[model samples]
Target: MLLKAKYKKNIFFFFKSLLISMQNFLKQFKPKKYKAYNKYVIVSAVYNVEKYLDDFFKSIINQRLDFKSNIYLICVDDGSTDNSANIIKKYQKKYPKNITYLYKENGGQASSRNLGLKYLKENDLNIFWVTFTDPDDFLDRDYFYEVDSFLKKQNNIAMVATNIIFY
Candidate 1:
């Protein structure tokens, strides 16, 4: 229990920094429209992850590609005792077409991710590549562009880890 709480706190801190940084970065951003949702984004959030949502949203909105529909947003609320579910629902209503919000029983992060995957598979969403983002992590707008381009150039690649700045 102690380790879990510690990790969650660290994750929360990292997530908070990400949001603040994104807010700062968002003061100057331009969208580049794309054809469709090119990559699948798996963002798993649980109780006490509220600190990171702002940064996650900011990072996503500032993505270089213009077409917001092309990127799938899978936000799973793992039976949050807090207002996590309500928060996710708010975003879902805001993005009824592009985002998916799942509220499952109080499970851990892994279970929540599995549920998100189940939703994807059930809905028959064909994803060429997949990546994960923590509720408290921030992403660079250019990160997707660089990764997608690199993957396309190198066909045999399966999975890769780029970078993350933890608190």
Candidate 2:
């Protein structure tokens, strides 16, 4: 009887430790949640854009903006034949809190944009503003700052457009 009791305790402890370790291992796979500020969603459609991705990423990440606003970048990979998806993934990993990368079948730019919009709606991000950009295009460093300032001062505007300068 003493031997049986000791075996049962050992089995129970073994299972308990196994369960604890399993939970700990699963915790590493859990997705992280980020706090949203004056949440702004920047959506982009990427298709075979590997060559331009680095500059696009650098431009977005380098934005000089107030901390009161948070930028959430959502890029839809519309069946990129090249390394565009991998490039986006690199940025996503680097800025996990600010980037959401999506993959979809070969769709045109509009379809990719629609998918991104749907994702924003489904996630219910409570977004305050939205902006779009092409993978080859870059924005000014103070783009978001100026946009945020303008929107704060204006009450009736639904959309604002900035002058685009092509070089």
Candidate 3:
């Protein structure tokens, strides 16, 4: 009986030590808590949509969200022969802090967008969400507001998409 009690006590101590070591090992992999940043980044590839540029810029500026601070517009001009680059420059001048314009050779839409992503990576801002738009496409006034609401409710969402209204 004495030997059995000693064996049980040794097993208990062994398990306790093992649990402590396991917890210490797992602590190294624990995810660090990050503060929530609600900044929205919009990247647009402009080729030759000068006609629709005004509407696109206006729609983004008139969003119901904090357009002045929380919203960022990245306009990538993919060698547009039209006045698209000028329009982008105008918006960039008007809202220098919120709008960024980048010029590149006549690359495809994907390449232009990739440049925008590269800019995001280089800057390394604490952006909560990143989205894409087109120069000829416009968004509703409450679009960002609605997206923010939905994202706030769902904690595990990796991406969120909205319906497109084709006219």
Give residue 72's lDDT in candidate 2 (0 to 100).
Answer: 85
Task: Count clashes in each candidate, considering only residues at least 3 apart in sequence or on different chains.
Answer: 6, 0, 0
Quick one: best TM-score, which candidate? 3
TM-score for each candidate, following the candidate numbering: 0.73, 0.74, 0.77
lDDT of each: 0.72, 0.82, 0.86
| lDDT agreement of model 1 with the native | 0.72
lDDT of 2 by residue, 24-120 (tens): 9999986443333245788899999899999998887777763224788999999989999899999899888788999999979999999999999
Native RMSD of candidate 2 (Å): 11.7
Worst 10 residues of 1 by lDDT: 30-39
lDDT tens string, model 1, 26-122? 9677455554325656556565687678778777766775426557788888776766667777877887776788888877878877888788888
Error of 3 at 156 (Å): 1.0
- In candidate 1 the C-alpha lDDT for residue 70 amounts to 58
